[model samples]
Target: MTSLADTPKAPGALRYTLLINAAPQSSQASKSALRFAESLLQMGHNIERLFFYGDGVLNASSLTVMPQDEINIPAAWHALIEANGLSSVVCVSSAIRRGIVDTAEAQRHELYATSCFTSSEIGGLGQLIEALSNSDRMLSFG
Candidate 1:
Protein backbone atom coordinates (compact mmCIF):
# COMPACT_ATOMS: atom_id res chain seq x y z
CA MET A 1 0.00 0.00 0.00
CA THR A 2 1.20 3.50 -0.82
CA SER A 3 1.35 5.71 2.20
CA LEU A 4 0.89 9.46 1.91
CA ALA A 5 3.55 10.00 4.55
CA ASP A 6 6.07 8.01 2.61
CA THR A 7 6.12 10.44 -0.27
CA PRO A 8 8.82 13.10 -0.32
CA LYS A 9 7.71 16.68 -0.47
CA ALA A 10 8.43 18.68 -3.61
CA PRO A 11 11.40 21.04 -3.43
CA GLY A 12 11.08 24.85 -3.30
CA ALA A 13 8.03 27.04 -2.92
CA LEU A 14 5.53 26.95 -5.76
CA ARG A 15 2.50 29.14 -6.19
CA TYR A 16 -0.68 28.03 -7.93
CA THR A 17 -4.01 29.46 -9.01
CA LEU A 18 -6.89 27.10 -9.62
CA LEU A 19 -9.43 28.43 -12.11
CA ILE A 20 -12.63 26.48 -11.64
CA ASN A 21 -15.18 26.76 -14.44
CA ALA A 22 -17.26 23.66 -13.82
CA ALA A 23 -20.55 23.58 -11.93
CA PRO A 24 -20.94 22.21 -8.42
CA GLN A 25 -23.05 19.29 -9.63
CA SER A 26 -20.10 18.15 -11.70
CA SER A 27 -18.04 15.92 -9.48
CA GLN A 28 -15.00 15.95 -11.71
CA ALA A 29 -14.13 19.61 -11.42
CA SER A 30 -14.71 19.94 -7.70
CA LYS A 31 -12.91 16.72 -6.92
CA SER A 32 -10.02 17.74 -9.09
CA ALA A 33 -9.83 21.10 -7.35
CA LEU A 34 -9.85 19.51 -3.93
CA ARG A 35 -7.14 17.08 -4.87
CA PHE A 36 -4.97 19.77 -6.38
CA ALA A 37 -5.37 21.96 -3.30
CA GLU A 38 -4.37 19.14 -0.99
CA SER A 39 -1.42 18.31 -3.16
CA LEU A 40 -0.25 21.91 -3.12
CA LEU A 41 -0.27 21.99 0.66
CA GLN A 42 1.43 18.64 0.84
CA MET A 43 4.09 19.85 -1.55
CA GLY A 44 4.63 23.06 0.40
CA HIS A 45 3.24 25.24 -2.34
CA ASN A 46 1.26 28.45 -1.89
CA ILE A 47 -2.00 29.19 -3.62
CA GLU A 48 -2.04 32.79 -4.78
CA ARG A 49 -5.54 32.84 -6.15
CA LEU A 50 -8.65 30.82 -6.89
CA PHE A 51 -10.51 32.68 -9.59
CA PHE A 52 -14.03 31.84 -10.77
CA TYR A 53 -14.94 32.60 -14.32
CA GLY A 54 -17.67 31.64 -16.80
CA ASP A 55 -19.71 28.95 -15.09
CA GLY A 56 -17.09 28.84 -12.36
CA VAL A 57 -18.57 31.91 -10.69
CA LEU A 58 -21.29 29.61 -9.45
CA ASN A 59 -18.84 28.17 -6.94
CA ALA A 60 -18.89 31.40 -4.94
CA SER A 61 -22.66 31.79 -4.96
CA SER A 62 -24.11 31.49 -1.47
CA LEU A 63 -27.52 30.62 -2.93
CA THR A 64 -26.77 26.92 -2.95
CA VAL A 65 -29.29 24.84 -1.06
CA MET A 66 -28.32 21.27 -0.33
CA PRO A 67 -29.92 18.47 1.65
CA GLN A 68 -29.23 18.13 5.33
CA ASP A 69 -26.82 15.28 4.75
CA GLU A 70 -25.25 16.73 1.61
CA ILE A 71 -21.99 18.64 1.50
CA ASN A 72 -21.99 22.40 1.09
CA ILE A 73 -19.15 22.85 -1.43
CA PRO A 74 -19.26 26.61 -1.82
CA ALA A 75 -19.07 27.07 1.91
CA ALA A 76 -16.28 24.57 2.17
CA TRP A 77 -14.29 26.33 -0.52
CA HIS A 78 -14.97 29.71 1.02
CA ALA A 79 -13.76 28.54 4.40
CA LEU A 80 -10.63 27.04 2.94
CA ILE A 81 -9.89 30.11 0.86
CA GLU A 82 -10.41 32.39 3.81
CA ALA A 83 -8.36 30.23 6.11
CA ASN A 84 -5.50 30.12 3.65
CA GLY A 85 -5.77 33.83 2.90
CA LEU A 86 -6.06 33.04 -0.76
CA SER A 87 -7.52 35.45 -3.23
CA SER A 88 -11.03 34.43 -4.24
CA VAL A 89 -12.43 36.27 -7.22
CA VAL A 90 -15.61 35.75 -9.21
CA CYS A 91 -15.97 37.18 -12.66
CA VAL A 92 -18.37 40.13 -12.62
CA SER A 93 -19.77 39.42 -16.05
CA SER A 94 -20.31 35.77 -15.35
CA ALA A 95 -21.78 36.46 -11.93
CA ILE A 96 -24.37 38.87 -13.29
CA ARG A 97 -25.26 36.50 -16.07
CA ARG A 98 -26.08 33.89 -13.45
CA GLY A 99 -27.91 36.35 -11.17
CA ILE A 100 -25.34 36.60 -8.36
CA VAL A 101 -25.18 39.97 -6.62
CA ASP A 102 -23.45 41.17 -3.50
CA THR A 103 -25.40 42.00 -0.34
CA ALA A 104 -24.96 45.76 -0.55
CA GLU A 105 -25.36 45.85 -4.31
CA ALA A 106 -28.28 43.43 -4.25
CA GLN A 107 -30.35 45.69 -2.02
CA ARG A 108 -29.23 48.76 -3.93
CA HIS A 109 -30.30 47.24 -7.21
CA GLU A 110 -33.30 45.58 -5.60
CA LEU A 111 -32.24 42.28 -7.12
CA TYR A 112 -31.88 39.25 -4.98
CA ALA A 113 -30.51 36.23 -6.76
CA THR A 114 -32.01 33.64 -4.44
CA SER A 115 -33.08 33.38 -0.83
CA CYS A 116 -29.73 31.97 0.26
CA PHE A 117 -27.65 33.96 -2.17
CA THR A 118 -24.61 35.89 -0.85
CA SER A 119 -22.53 37.42 -3.54
CA SER A 120 -18.76 37.63 -3.86
CA GLU A 121 -17.22 40.80 -5.22
CA ILE A 122 -17.19 40.92 -9.02
CA GLY A 123 -13.87 40.50 -10.81
CA GLY A 124 -12.66 39.97 -14.34
CA LEU A 125 -10.50 37.59 -16.35
CA GLY A 126 -7.64 40.02 -16.05
CA GLN A 127 -7.44 39.35 -12.33
CA LEU A 128 -7.04 35.68 -13.04
CA ILE A 129 -4.36 36.42 -15.59
CA GLU A 130 -2.59 38.54 -13.01
CA ALA A 131 -2.70 35.69 -10.54
CA LEU A 132 -1.15 33.41 -13.11
CA SER A 133 1.52 35.92 -13.79
CA ASN A 134 2.30 36.29 -10.09
CA SER A 135 2.33 32.59 -9.36
CA ASP A 136 5.07 30.16 -10.19
CA ARG A 137 2.57 27.75 -11.69
CA MET A 138 -1.06 28.07 -12.69
CA LEU A 139 -3.34 25.07 -12.78
CA SER A 140 -6.84 25.13 -14.24
CA PHE A 141 -9.00 22.40 -12.75
CA GLY A 142 -11.92 22.91 -15.11
Candidate 2:
Protein backbone atom coordinates (compact mmCIF):
# COMPACT_ATOMS: atom_id res chain seq x y z
CA MET A 1 0.00 0.00 0.00
CA THR A 2 1.24 3.51 -0.87
CA SER A 3 0.72 6.47 1.40
CA LEU A 4 -0.83 9.60 -0.05
CA ALA A 5 2.36 11.55 0.43
CA ASP A 6 4.34 8.81 -1.24
CA THR A 7 2.09 8.70 -4.24
CA PRO A 8 2.99 10.87 -7.21
CA LYS A 9 0.81 13.75 -8.25
CA ALA A 10 -1.79 12.46 -10.72
CA PRO A 11 -0.84 15.20 -13.21
CA GLY A 12 2.86 15.21 -12.34
CA ALA A 13 2.73 18.96 -11.69
CA LEU A 14 0.24 21.56 -10.56
CA ARG A 15 0.27 25.18 -11.70
CA TYR A 16 -1.96 27.93 -10.40
CA THR A 17 -3.05 31.44 -11.32
CA LEU A 18 -4.64 33.83 -8.86
CA LEU A 19 -7.04 36.71 -9.37
CA ILE A 20 -7.79 39.23 -6.60
CA ASN A 21 -10.69 41.63 -6.97
CA ALA A 22 -10.77 43.20 -3.55
CA ALA A 23 -8.87 46.04 -2.00
CA PRO A 24 -6.41 45.08 0.71
CA GLN A 25 -7.92 47.41 3.30
CA SER A 26 -11.65 46.80 2.96
CA SER A 27 -11.34 43.04 2.65
CA GLN A 28 -9.01 40.18 3.54
CA ALA A 29 -9.13 38.74 0.05
CA SER A 30 -5.71 39.96 -1.08
CA LYS A 31 -3.95 38.76 2.04
CA SER A 32 -5.80 35.49 2.05
CA ALA A 33 -4.92 34.84 -1.58
CA LEU A 34 -1.25 35.56 -0.95
CA ARG A 35 -1.20 33.26 2.06
CA PHE A 36 -2.75 30.46 0.06
CA ALA A 37 -0.24 30.92 -2.76
CA GLU A 38 2.65 30.88 -0.33
CA SER A 39 1.41 27.67 1.23
CA LEU A 40 0.92 26.10 -2.17
CA LEU A 41 4.49 26.96 -3.19
CA GLN A 42 5.81 25.48 0.05
CA MET A 43 3.93 22.33 -0.82
CA GLY A 44 5.92 22.18 -4.09
CA HIS A 45 3.27 23.63 -6.39
CA ASN A 46 3.86 26.29 -9.05
CA ILE A 47 2.30 29.73 -9.23
CA GLU A 48 2.07 31.16 -12.71
CA ARG A 49 0.89 34.66 -11.90
CA LEU A 50 -0.92 36.86 -9.40
CA PHE A 51 -3.36 39.13 -11.22
CA PHE A 52 -4.78 42.06 -9.32
CA TYR A 53 -7.94 43.45 -10.84
CA GLY A 54 -10.93 45.67 -10.02
CA ASP A 55 -10.33 47.33 -6.67
CA GLY A 56 -7.52 44.91 -6.06
CA VAL A 57 -5.31 47.10 -8.24
CA LEU A 58 -4.75 49.14 -5.12
CA ASN A 59 -2.45 46.38 -3.95
CA ALA A 60 0.04 47.48 -6.57
CA SER A 61 -0.05 51.15 -5.65
CA SER A 62 3.02 52.70 -4.13
CA LEU A 63 0.96 55.50 -2.64
CA THR A 64 -1.05 53.24 -0.35
CA VAL A 65 -1.02 54.69 3.14
CA MET A 66 -1.89 52.69 6.23
CA PRO A 67 -1.97 53.20 9.95
CA GLN A 68 1.08 52.05 11.87
CA ASP A 69 -0.93 49.30 13.52
CA GLU A 70 -2.08 47.70 10.27
CA ILE A 71 -0.32 44.97 8.35
CA ASN A 72 1.31 46.18 5.11
CA ILE A 73 -0.26 43.97 2.48
CA PRO A 74 1.60 45.48 -0.46
CA ALA A 75 4.90 45.19 1.38
CA ALA A 76 4.20 41.57 2.10
CA TRP A 77 3.51 40.98 -1.58
CA HIS A 78 6.70 42.80 -2.54
CA ALA A 79 8.74 40.64 -0.20
CA LEU A 80 7.10 37.48 -1.42
CA ILE A 81 7.70 38.37 -5.06
CA GLU A 82 11.30 39.34 -4.38
CA ALA A 83 11.98 36.23 -2.36
CA ASN A 84 10.20 33.75 -4.62
CA GLY A 85 10.63 35.46 -7.99
CA LEU A 86 6.89 35.19 -8.47
CA SER A 87 5.14 37.19 -11.15
CA SER A 88 2.87 40.01 -9.97
CA VAL A 89 0.67 41.56 -12.62
CA VAL A 90 -1.97 44.23 -12.22
CA CYS A 91 -4.75 44.83 -14.73
CA VAL A 92 -3.97 47.98 -16.69
CA SER A 93 -7.52 49.29 -16.91
CA SER A 94 -8.16 48.68 -13.25
CA ALA A 95 -4.81 50.08 -12.22
CA ILE A 96 -5.14 53.30 -14.15
CA ARG A 97 -8.57 53.94 -12.78
CA ARG A 98 -7.32 53.19 -9.27
CA GLY A 99 -4.21 55.41 -9.61
CA ILE A 100 -1.74 52.56 -9.71
CA VAL A 101 0.56 53.91 -12.38
CA ASP A 102 3.81 52.62 -13.73
CA THR A 103 6.45 54.88 -15.25
CA ALA A 104 5.27 54.38 -18.80
CA GLU A 105 1.63 54.78 -18.00
CA ALA A 106 2.29 57.85 -15.91
CA GLN A 107 4.30 59.42 -18.67
CA ARG A 108 1.71 58.57 -21.23
CA HIS A 109 -1.03 60.06 -19.12
CA GLU A 110 1.12 63.08 -18.13
CA LEU A 111 0.92 62.32 -14.42
CA TYR A 112 3.52 61.89 -11.72
CA ALA A 113 5.24 58.56 -12.04
CA THR A 114 4.98 57.56 -8.44
CA SER A 115 2.06 55.25 -7.91
CA CYS A 116 3.02 51.67 -8.72
CA PHE A 117 5.37 49.61 -6.62
CA THR A 118 8.42 48.12 -8.30
CA SER A 119 7.20 44.58 -7.76
CA SER A 120 4.02 45.17 -9.71
CA GLU A 121 3.70 44.99 -13.48
CA ILE A 122 0.90 46.72 -15.34
CA GLY A 123 -0.70 44.33 -17.79
CA GLY A 124 -3.95 43.66 -19.65
CA LEU A 125 -6.79 41.16 -19.47
CA GLY A 126 -4.80 39.08 -21.91
CA GLN A 127 -2.35 38.28 -19.14
CA LEU A 128 -5.10 36.84 -16.99
CA ILE A 129 -6.47 34.91 -19.96
CA GLU A 130 -3.02 33.51 -20.68
CA ALA A 131 -2.53 32.43 -17.11
CA LEU A 132 -5.91 30.76 -17.01
CA SER A 133 -5.12 28.98 -20.19
CA ASN A 134 -1.74 27.65 -19.06
CA SER A 135 -2.27 26.96 -15.38
CA ASP A 136 -3.97 23.94 -13.97
CA ARG A 137 -6.14 26.11 -11.72
CA MET A 138 -7.32 29.69 -11.46
CA LEU A 139 -8.45 30.81 -8.03
CA SER A 140 -10.23 34.09 -7.41
CA PHE A 141 -10.61 36.16 -4.25
CA GLY A 142 -12.87 39.11 -3.85
Clashing pairs in 2: none
Stretches of candidate 2 off by over 4 Å are 1-12
For every candidate structure, what is the RMSD over all alpha carbons to the true structure, in angstroms? 5.2, 5.8
Pairs in clash, predicted candidate 1:
none
**TM-scores of all candidate predictions against the true structure:** 0.79, 0.88
C-alpha RMSD of candidate 2: 5.8
The 10-residue segment of model 2 with minimum total lDDT is 1-10
lDDT of 2 by residue, 84-115 (tens): 77788999998888788988998999996668
Error of 1 at 136 (Å): 1.2
Instruction: Mark the 10 consecutive residues where model 1 has the least summed lDDT.
Output: 1-10
